[model samples]
Target: MTLKLLVFIHLLLLIFMAVGCNAQHSPEDFDQVNLINSAGPYLGLVVPNSFELAPLLDPSTFIPSKNVSHIDLSGRRFHVGIIADQKVIVVMTGLAMTYGQGEDDELAWESNGDYTRDIGYIHFANYSTEESCDNLLNNVWFNPDEIFPKNGIPEVREHAFWVNVSETYYNLAEQLQNVTLESCINSTTCLPTTPKIVKVERGCSASILAANAAYKNLLHEKFNCTLIDMESAAVALVSLSMGKPFIIIRALSGLAFSNLASKNAVIALTKFFELLSDKPTNGIEMYDK
Candidate 1:
């Protein structure tokens, strides 16, 4: 073969090798890098993707994903501001439906949902509060909410669900003393306001019903938490394992077990981000009693 022909053959071989390497990269191969971590204090903002989370981000910079949901591609994931400086990474901990459809495990998941999909998010699930919250609904065949007698008082009132929002953040309230959210673009009536600081021992994020009387009371008595959501616990879990400073703040737009207006959800998330940019209140500590 001529010299030119041989050079072309070598170029093709190089291209093939590059393509092969790229294609071989599975989700597990990239897990460590993509999972959130910081050498100093970092914030992991977990929310369900809804009108609730949208207005909190900068205008249009954090729009919904146009890409399909892929386990490794992170089509549903995105960032705001500078990661190094702001230390903020917004996480959309998908709802009950999203978990069943996307993940591949059944351990923590309770549902008409099955765990047969990509468990690329396992690191997050595995990391929520130490001890893995294994006893969250301990000794119950059905979910605690399912099996707990409709009228029966909880048997496990002192159960500690767990939290990983680091001790550093517990006293970081001084940093947020002067901040406020002045407005919300996506909301007409959600209205901008200040965020509150609370030392919520255990935060649970799930369906609206989970925030109701029997279930809500159980969390309050067992874990000493009064707020509810499906996102916080899981986020706290991941933060603990990663050794990042984390906290979950929520607002009560509507009473739990009552009609939760969309605006209420939006308002709660609004305060969450505002709190993210600042620290909790100083002097007045969130009490355990």
Candidate 2:
């Protein structure tokens, strides 16, 4: 879809924090030169892998017709379909980074984690300490520098970059913060409390998939980021560079190496789509949390 149309529909991009582990490669690895330019108008849904994709594919949510188009570009597959009466193009993101890697069956997703919220702003930083940031800039695998120049985005720097989520979309999310979400994975497994949306002051995005408590603490205490992610910053940068408004809704599956995180990313997304179907007025007032 064209960038303007993407913003028009309030393309609420749902990206889970857990997906950070799978994105270890660059998009150029797939040779997707015209991937975005040639696409049609549709809401774009980006998920990290199958675990997140499974919920959306349920017949209750996604409806596909015989006229569905399956376009294979490089190693990634794009599925065009309908969801909540909105035409959508759903694609599993991080494919290029994981193309050659074999299946990771051991990987699991949980919906009960801390800081499950709709993101308002993103702060990008190096995965390593400042002492190593320079080294990382020179040796990183998925450097944004190469892509930014072509898109007219500012060149990547060894320091951090900050960007804001679309105010329109953020306000919509703010309205949904109090909406209750499913807390049970099944009758036997359940969360102590249901998931709810909250506005984060900032979210830290780096290429590294962090599972260390010390690092997670640094992001919180030092950067003032309530959540950590790997993809949203890059997505935010590209969207801003094109002057397209976007919002990233994130659900925490777990906390840095802690197995206690819940699995509500899908549940959160389902609630979001249900709201989109209603086409709510953007006039809803929101408060900072």
Candidate 3:
């Protein structure tokens, strides 16, 4: 071969070697098996809101003996609670928006010129309103006999039980309802009112998106975990599109599309943990079979 031709061939070989090296150094260089324990599946516990997981926030108060860890993504403060060799992460969602703020003047007007009485009354009113609404809704929508047939009643109740107990769900529902009611009331009061979006779009928050992204990134970075629970449907979509195994362990936080509270939330969480404990981690190994 001519000198020029030989030079060209050498350059092509160098290019090929460089491409091979780059490909070898790609993100997939990390092995999934090496990151997570080969003995069991890594559980991804996701609480919808911070309040739902308040009990588990302090590891010193309640420690689990199982091989599990917890992450708290409830507010601005992110905390990880590890128990029984498991990891738990805690995250904060920031200050939640509530109804109109009560001013000192308003308090004075409401209370007989007594700050203490005003505070007590306000507290009582808040609890009373919440209890009244909860009782009304629970009696109406949660009438097992009317809502579900005898055969399906047990299944429906089982699914909704957890959500019924969670405060997060109730708070969310109350907020949405408050917004809706205020809008409707304002529209009624104002003439020539403009058209407004009355329906609250469920599960559409930047915080939620950020939390899921951070979660997936952490899983990939730390445990090389590709298989994840299907709590966040949006996250599931992204994972599924990427050809990842997205297993969902939703414990039915509430009705098909309803708010959750104390009973409902706790039951869902407890059931999820129970299911995780009962299921065989190796039932369907990811990246293996």
Q: Candidate 1, overall lDDT?
A: 0.37
Model 2 pairs in collision: 110-262, 110-263, 111-262, 111-263, 111-264, 112-261, 112-262, 112-263, 113-262
Cα RMSD for candidate 2? 12.0
Poorest stretch of ten by lDDT in candidate 2:
1-10
After superposition, which runs of candidate 3 have C-alpha atoms over 4 Å from their true positions?
A: 1-41, 56-231, 241-263, 283-289
Every candidate's lDDT: 0.37, 0.50, 0.28
Error of 2 at 248 (Å): 1.0
| Candidate achieving the largest lDDT | 2
Q: How would you order the candidates by lDDT, starting with the best?
A: 2, 1, 3
Q: Residue 159 lDDT in model 2?
A: 27
Q: Write the per-residue lDDT of candidate 1 for residues 54-138, one digit (tens) a residue.
A: 5445443333222211123333453423221333445454555322222433322344242334444433345445665653333
TM match of model 2 to true structure: 0.60
On TM-score, the stronger of 1 and 3 is 1
Query: Which stretches in model 2 have alpha-carbon errors above 4 Å?
Result: 1-39, 95-160, 255-263, 277-289
lDDT of 3 by residue, 97-133 (tens): 1112235423211233222332332232343356445
